[model samples]
Target: MAETNDILEVAKMTISTSIKCNTVRGFIGWHSCDNICMDMHDVLDMCEDAFKRERYQESLEADTYVLVSGVKLASCADSSSGMLTDVIMRAFELIDLSTQTIAKLDAAMRKHALSLIIKEAKKKAFDGWDSWRYELLEKAVCLCDEKLAAKLEKLLDIFLEDIENDYMPEYKRQEDTILRYKLHRHLKGADAVKDELYANLYIREMCIIAVKDATDARNYNEAEKLCLEQIKKEDGRFYRNTPEDWNNILFDVYMQSGITDKQIEQAKKILLLGNEGFWDVLKRLYQSQGIWESQKPILLKELKQCKYSVCYRSVLVKENEKKLLLEAVTENPYNLFYYAQFLVMDYPNEIYELCANYIREQCAQATDRRLYKKVCKDLLQLIKWKGNATAKLLVDEFKATYPRRSALLDELQKVEKKL
Candidate 1:
C-alpha cells in the first residue's frame, strides 16, 4: 500500500507539471489518447483538486507543465488553429523559465509563431469573419510592444490598401455611391478627398451637401450661392407655380440669410399667389411686417374656405367676418353659445334677437338635465345682458325641461327675480 501511494504521488506530480508546461505553450491537447496524453478536464480537475488539498507545490508544478505542453503543441500547430498561441508564448516569456530553456527556442520558431498570427488574421478577413477579425485585431494590438504598435500601424495601412484595392468598388454597388463616398470621407478626416468626391457626385446631391456643409461651417455667402444654385436647378413650374413650395424655400432663405424686411416683402410677393393655404403664411408674414389689419381680409377669405363642418364651426367664432359668424351660428344653433359670448363683447344689439331665437330653439330640444342646464346658463346670461322680451319665455322653458334639477331651476328663477 505504501509503495502504491508513492507511485501515485509521483505520477500526479508528472501529470500536473506536464499540463502546466503544455498550457504555457498555448495548445489544448486531445481529450482521449494514450496514457501519456491528458484529458483537458482531467488536467483541470487535478489542478483544482491539488489546490483544494493545499498541495501548493504540486499545483504550481501542474500549472507549469500544462502551460509548457500547450506551448509545444502551439509551436507545431497550423496557423488556422483556434488556440491563443501568441498570448501563451508571450506569457511564457514572463514565466520562470530558465535562460537556457528560453535561449533554446530557435529564431524560426518565434518567426513562425508571428506569421501564424498574421496568417490567421488575413484568413479571418477573407472569410467575412467580423467577430474573429475584431477579436484578433484587438488581441494583436494589445500584445504589440511599443515597437510592434508602430509596425502594426503599418500593417493596418496594408490592410486598408487590401480593402480599397479588392473591396471598395465591389462594396459600393448602389446608386448612392457618391453619398457613400462623402460619408466615408467625413469619417476618414479627408476634407480634400470629400471635396473631390463631392465634385463628381450627382448635381442635386452635390448642391445639397455643399449648402449643408457651408451652413454648418457658417460660410453664409457660400451657403447662399449654393441655395440659389439649387433653386435654379429645381423645375420652375413646380417651385414657382406652387405657393407652398415657393413660400417654404423663400422663408428658409429669408430667415437664414437675415434678408431685410423690404427683401422679405419682395420675396413674399414672388412666392405667395393668394392660395387658400397661403393664409397662414400671409398672416405670419404680415405680422412680421406689423400689418395685422391688412391680414384681416385674407383671414376672412380663409374662414370662407373652411368647407368641413368641424373647421367651419371652430374658425367661424374667431373670424373677422361677422356675417359668416352669424350665419354659422344660425345654421348650428349650439354654435350660438360661442356667438353669444362674442356678441356680448363685440356687437351687443346686433346679436340680441339672434341670441333670443337660439335660446328658444335650444330649450325646445333640451330633453336631458345636462342639455337643459347648458341652455339655461346661456339664456340667463343673454337675458341679463340685453333684457330681451323672450327672457320670461326662456325662464319657463328651463323649468319645464329640468323639473328634477330643481336647484338649477331655482338658480334661473333667482335671475328672473333680480330682473
Candidate 2:
C-alpha cells in the first residue's frame, strides 16, 4: 500500500509537463491508480502501457475516455487537439477492438467511480447496442472517412470467418456473438416489418432464438409453442440440410427439457421428419410408440426405406425385423451400412461374412473411386467400432485386390493403428 501511494505521489507531481510521459512509462511495469494523467498524449500513452501490462481495467478507463473525448473535443471549442482521433485509432489497432476488453470496461463502470468522459463512452458504446460490432463500425467511421468505414465493414463481414493465425479464442467468440446480436435485433425490427419474403427469412431464425431463449429459461410451453408454430408454418416442407433434418432442433429441445409424454405426438411428428434416418430421435420415437404387435408391415417398409435407420436397432435383434433386415441387405447391398449397425448388435460373425462378401464383390469390380472411397470409409468405421474379424477380412481382401494401388494401400496403412 505504501509503495503504490508513493508511486501515485510521484505520478501526481509529473501530471502536466512532458515528464508526465515518464509517469505513463512508469505505469507500463507497475500498478495503475486514479488520476494518472489528464493530458491527451499522456492518457493515450498510459492506456497503451496499461494494456501492455494486461491491466485492462485501467487501460479501458483511459482508452475509452480518449476515444469518446476525441469525438466530442474535435467538434467542440477544443478542436485544437483534433489529433486525439488518431490516438484513438492507434489504441483500437492495439486492442483489436476486443469484445472481452469492452466487457471488462462495462463491468468496471458498474463498480468504480468512473470519469464523466468514460461514463459517456460506456453509454455510447453499449447502452442501446446488443454487442460491439456497430460500436467498432462507429469507431472506424470516426477515425477515417464515412465511405472508407463502410467499405471496411463490408470487407470485414465477408472475411470475419476467414481471418486466421490469431491465438485468442475470445476474439472469435466476440465476433460470432456480435453477429448473432446484430441478427436478433435486425430480425426484431425492420425485418419483422418487411415484405413477405424478407419477413419469412427471419421465421426460422426467430423460431430458433425463441426456442433457445425459452429453453434457457425453462419455459417449456413457450419453447414447444414456438417449435410447433415452425412446424405448422413449414407444413411438411421441412427442408433438411446436409446431415440434419430441419426439425432436429425441435426434437432436441424437447428431449433436453426432460419433459415426457406417453402420447408422443411430438415424437411421432419427429419420426415423420426422416432423412436416411441415422439419428437418435427416431429411437426415442419408437420407444414412445410402444411397437405394437400390429405395426409389422409398416415396420418392414420403413426398415427397407430408411436403410440407415436406427429407430428400431435395439429391438431388431429380438423382433421380426431381423429377417427383413437380412432380406433388405440381400436386395440392396448398400443396405449393409445400416444392416451392419443392427447386425453387429447380435450377429457380429454373420455380419463379418456379409462384410467379407461385399469386399469381395467390390474388389472384383472395375475401379469406381467414389464408391471405393465410401466403402473404405465404412470399413474403417466398422473396424474402429471393434468389428475385428470383419475389418481384418475386408482389409485382407483390399490388399489382395488392390495390391498395385500403392497410394491407396499407404493411406489405408496410415489408419492401421485404428485396426
Candidate 3:
C-alpha cells in the first residue's frame, strides 16, 4: 500500500508537468502540432475538467497553475501581456464556481488568483480603453467574498489613480471621465448617470458615447445638437482635419427621421467631403422633392468648387456631362486612358490624339521596366477601345524615340504582339 501510494504521487506530478508543457506549447503555437487557440483550450480544459468532477480546489489549482505558467511563458516569449491576461481570465471563468461555492473556497487562494489576473491586465499600456479589463475585474468582484470584493474594488480605484498621472493631462482627464462614467453607469444604471459635454478633450470618444446615449433615448434634437456642437468644437482646432464623424451621426439621424431637407443637407455635406455614396442619396432626396432640375446645377457648382471632390468626377460621369468630363480629362491627362472610354464614342479622333500625345510623354520620361509596362498597358487599352491604328502608331513612335532603351523595347514588343 505504501509503494502504491508513492507511485500515485509520482503519476500526479508527471501529469501536472505534462499539462504545463502542453499549456505553454498551445498558448504560443510553439510546437508544430500546437496552435495558440488549441493550447489555450488545453489550459481551460484542465480547470473545466476538474470543476466538472466536483473537485473545486483542484479546479482553482488549475487556474492558478495556468495563470502563473502563462505569466512566466509571456516573459520568455514575445507574446503580449494582454494576451496572458485574457488567458488567465478565461481560466478563472472556466472554474465555474458559483457565488455559493466561491463563499466556501479558501479566501486567500481566491484573492491571489483574482489579483494575479488583474495585475497582469494592468501590465498592458493604458490606452484610455482599459474599461474592458476593469469589466473583468468587476466580474471578479462579484465572484469574491465581500472583504475580497472591497479589496479588488480598491485595487481598481488605485489602477485608475495610476493612469490619471499619465504625462498627457488632457488624455488622462478625458479617459478618467469616460471610465468613471462607465463605472457609474454599471453601478447606478445608465439612466442615473447624467450626460456630460466633452468639448475640450482632443479625444472625442467621450463625446461619441454621449451622442450615442442621447440617440438611444430617442432624443433626436439632443443627438443632433451634440453632433453639431462637436463639429463646431472640432472646427476651432486647426491641428486636426474636419471629423466626418459628426456628419455621419447627423446622416444616420436624418435617414432614421426620413427628414428629406435634413437628408439633402447632410448628404451634400458628406459628398463635398468626397464621400460619393451620398451622391445618390442627395439626388434621390432632391428628386423626391420634385426640385432635382433646379438643384442639379447648384450641386454641380459646389462639387466643382471643392477642388479635390471625388463626387465631382462621379457626378459628371453619371450626369453624362460629356463636355465637363472631357475638360477634366484634358486638365489631368494622367486620367486620360481611364476617361477615354467615356469620351471615346463622342470624340474618337480626339481620344486617339490624346492617347498618342500621352504615350509620347510617358515614353520620353519612363526609364524603368515598370513604367514601360504601364505605358504598354495603356496602349493595350487604346486597342481595346478600337484605337488599333493609334496603338500601332504609338508603338512605332516609342521604338524610334527610345531606340537605345532595351527595357522599353522589351515592354513595347509585348504591346506590339498584342496590337
Candidate 4:
C-alpha cells in the first residue's frame, strides 16, 4: 500500500528516467504480454478485486501510477502508441470509479491526480502531440472541480483555434480540424454541432462522423444533405472523379429511404469509382425498375471509359464479354496469364499465340535471375493450359538466344524438364 506522496515521487522519478533513457518499462507488467487487450482487461479485474477486499487506497495509487506511466509511454511509443494511450484512459476510468470511497478518506486525492494530469497535458501540448494533449485535457476536466473544469474547457477552446497561416502542413491542419470537431461536440452538444460539422465537411474525418451521426439519429434528411453537399463539393477534385465514400453514404441513405431512382444514380457513381459490389446493386436496382436492357449498355460504356482499369476489366468478366476481355489482353500482353484461363477454352488457339508471344517478349527483356525465373513461371502457365508445343519452342528459343547467360540457362533447363 503505497502512500500518496510515495506514489507521486515514484511517478516523477519514472518520468525523469524515461525521458533520460528514451525507453519505458511496461507499467504493472500489464503490457508485457502478447495479448495486450486481454491483459488490460485483467487490470480492470484487479481493480474489482481491490474493491471487494476494501483496499481502495491500493487501487487508487496503482491506477494513478499507471495513468502517469501511460502518458509518458504513449508519447514515446511508435506503432502501438494509440493502444498505450488507451491504457491511460482505462486507468483514469478505474480511478474515477473508485473516487467515491477514496474521497471519503482523503478528499484531496482527486485534486492531486488532476494536477498531475494537467501537468502532463501541458507538457504534451508543448511537445506538439496536440492530439494526445487534447485527450489528456479532456480527461483532466472530468476529474477536477467545477472552476478547474471550466478553466480546462477554456484552455481547450484556445488550443483548438484554427491557424490561418498558409504554410502549415496539410496533415497538421487535418489533425487540428479533427480535434476541433471533437471539441465542438463536447462544448456545443451533439445536435448543435451538426451544422458546424457540415460546414467543415471538407475535412474527411468530420464528414464521416457527421454522416454517421445523421444516419444514427434516423435523420435521413440531414444525412442526405450532408452526403450530397460533400459529394458535390468533392466533384471533379480527383481527376474529375466522384467522391466514393460520400457517394456510398448517399446510396445507403437512398436505400434506407426507399428511393430507387436515387439509389440507381448513386450506385453508378460508386461503381465507376471501383466498388465492385455496386455492380450487382445497380443490376438489382435496374431490374427492379424494369430498365436493365435500356441501362446495361450505358453502364458498360461508362465503365469502359473509366480511368480505373481494374473496374473495366472486372466488369468485363462479370458481363462475360469475351471479346472485350480479348481486346484487353491484346492491349496488354502481360495480362495473358490472367485472362488466358478465362479465354483458353473458347479461343484456345488465340490464347496459345498470346502466351507464346508474351513469353518471347519477356525472354527478350530478361536481364537478371529474377526476370528469368519469372519467364519460367509464365512458361509453366503455358504448359498448364496444354500449350506444351509453345512452351518447348520458347524454351528452345531461350536456350539459343542466351547461351552464355548462366542464370537464364539454368531457368531454361528447369522449364525444359517440364516441357
**Per-residue lDDT over 1-419 for candidate 4, one digit per residue giving the tens place of the 0 to 100 score:** 33433544544454455434443463323233213433444454565567567766556665655565555545444525256656666876776666555544444665665565555555542354555555544444334455545655565555546554424446556765666566556656788877778777778788788777877888888889887777778774433243446676688788887877788887888788777768898998899889998998888888878876777777888889888888888787746688788898888888989888888888889899999999999998888888899889888887888889899998888888887
C-alpha positional error of residue 389 in candidate 4 after TM-score superposition, expressed in Å: 1.2
In order of lDDT, best first, we have 4, 3, 2, 1
Quantify all predictions' global Cα lDDT against the true fold.
0.49, 0.50, 0.65, 0.68
Q: Can you tell me which runs of candidate 2 are displaced by over 4 Å? A: 1-54, 57-203, 212-225, 232-246, 252-259, 271-324, 335-364, 367-419
**2 or 3: which has the higher TM-score?**
3
lDDT of 1 at 131: 32
The TM-score of candidate 1 is: 0.34
Q: What TM-score, computed on C-alpha atoms, does each candidate reach?
A: 0.34, 0.36, 0.65, 0.66
Candidate 2 contains a number of clashing pairs equal to: 0
Q: Pick the candidate with the highest TM-score.
A: 4
lDDT of 3 by residue, 234-348 (tens): 6833221344477787778767766777888878888887776677888888888899899888888888888554457877888899888877777777567777888999988
Q: Which regions in candidate 4 have their CA more than 4 angstroms from the true location?
A: 1-120, 123-126, 135-149, 157-225, 238-244, 290-294, 318-323
**CA RMSD of each candidate after superposition:** 22.3, 15.6, 8.3, 7.0
lDDT for each residue of candidate 1 in 66-175, tens digit (9 for 90 to 100)? 44444444344342433434433432332222211222345443233334344544542233433333333333332233444455455545555555454443432222
> Clashing residue pairs in candidate 3, if any?
26-39
Q: Would you list the clashing residue pairs of candidate 2?
A: none
Question: How does model 4 fare in lDDT?
Answer: 0.68
Best candidate per lDDT, number?
Answer: 4
Report the alpha-carbon TM-score of model 2 versus the true structure: 0.36
